[model samples]
Target: MDKPKVAADSPAQVELEEGKKYAYCTCGLSETQPFCDGKHMSTDFRPHVFTAEKTETCYFCRCKQTGDAPRCDGSHKKLQEPERKG
Candidate 1:
């Protein structure tokens, strides 16, 4: 099993439909970004299957470091990257 890859350092804003089934990519390997495109099949990662509670714009976690799966808990804001000396 491989650790999840960071798709981005920010959350992805997406529009979700109420009662709609969605597949959120836990593995950042997906070229589809926040959504699953079956890229996790090569790894131990799997999509976070969920249904939309309400039709609204939502921020989805892309960093894959959120304690809350598929939700942006502002975890990306806490990622520590090496400071560039340039």
Candidate 2:
């Protein structure tokens, strides 16, 4: 059996700015990842709200398979790690 794959266009992404609020995407269908692109019209998913207090970047969950919604749970690392060398 093949491992399940997550869509490339998953609703994952996050921006950080001092005292700034952003609307994140959680439907994995948004044209804009981590942002509410109004693509949740056809799905039952809703946009998520996030705030920042510093100029930083955050990893949003693009797989939608994370137990921690709207955040990455090292899932990307699994896909990005290099194969072990002997």
Candidate 2 stretches greater than 4 Å from native: 1-5, 9-14, 76-86
Q: What's each prediction's clash count?
A: 0, 0
TM-score per prediction, in order, is 0.89, 0.64
lDDT of 1 at 49: 93
Q: What lDDT, from 0 to 1, does candidate 1 have?
A: 0.85
Over 1-86, each residue of candidate 1 has an lDDT whose tens digit, in order, gives: 46788888888899999999999999888888799999899898889999999999988988888898888998887776841111
Question: Judged by lDDT against the true structure, how good is candidate 2?
Answer: 0.60
Residue pair clashes in candidate 2: none
lDDT of 2 by residue, 16-70 (tens): 7988887766666665665678877766777788676687777776655566756
Return the lDDT, model 2, position 58.
73
Best by TM-score: 1
Model 1 segments beyond 4 Å from truth? 82-86
TM-score between model 1 and native: 0.89
